[model samples]
Target: MKLKGSMWSCIGLATLLMAGCDKSPPISTAEEQPSAPKKQVAFQPDWVPKALGSGNFEVCLSNEAEENGVKDLILPVGMMFDSWGHMTGSLRDSKAFDGEGTSGFGKSDQYALALTARVHLTSDRPCAITQAQAVTHQGFRYRHETVPASLHYNFSAGGLYLNKKGGITNDMKGPAGDAAQIGLLSGTPISDVGDVYRATEDL
Candidate 1:
């Protein structure tokens, strides 16, 4: 009887030890763990002509804050009616402003697109800055082309000349091939001309 009692006691202890070993550490509850909030990236402007549909847009802060700056500029400015707009750079693919709708706008119309870039906005909501918008109920078709752009003040020259102060824009990379030397400037989310894109649908 004494031996049996001792055996039972040992078995109980072993069972308890095994049970404890089998048990898992307390599992974390969802409440115990929290997740970080995501950044805001959605905002559509009414200015994008209804015809071309919508565009792939990211928060300006996304591109603006980048080390190299915007790779491609989604321009808010558009042609007259049904202006889908351009996404790359330079407004005029051609040097001849007389293409059709190019002149009247200006001769400098051939300058870099970044110099005259604009973005879209519903209202000047606290979220984003508003520029220009489409006034013409009818929008126009537009095209885009990437061109070499030199944007900066002459490190030594400064202005148009070395002594002058104001200057144009440029990418971090040195200008190569054919490029336009344009000043750095921004346009309204909406443009007066929508800065009528420098191309025409007539041809």
Candidate 2:
């Protein structure tokens, strides 16, 4: 009986020792590494134009803000349209500016379907701060030799370059092609030129 009790005691001690050995140590996590900083791009005004319909379009005015100080001063002054409404075609100079519809507007009236260049907006509503829109014209002729373009009605919407300081430079990569011209006039957004037209019609 004494031998048997001693044997059981020894077995219990062995079992407890085995159980302790089977237990796992607590897991620990490593410290996290710090993240790198992000870089910023500059805003330089680069105007581009795109057509929506036969006589409708949208323009995008991009101002790339560079980290470097070298920049360009783009002007806003352009052809001043008069009471005669939106002129058409390659007709550069029209007849004597009429009184009512007799006022005049001027720009490099290329033979393309739409005005060549775009300008930036002045207002804030409808998200038109650094935005651009299409310029309209009538009576201009087009040919297959160049890209197709839409027409501009009397009430067509467009962008106006206000506070322009840069010379006319065609930076097509920014928005549209280089065929368009940048104006030298300074003005505001003519919201009444018609309602905002969608950038893309086909969805």
| Candidate with maximal lDDT | 2
lDDT of 2 by residue, 1-24 (tens): 012223446888999998898887
RMSD of each: 26.8, 30.1
Candidate 2's C-alpha runs over 4 A off are 1-82, 85-90, 101-160, 163-193, 196-203
TM-score for every candidate vs. truth?
0.17, 0.17
Clashes of 2: 42
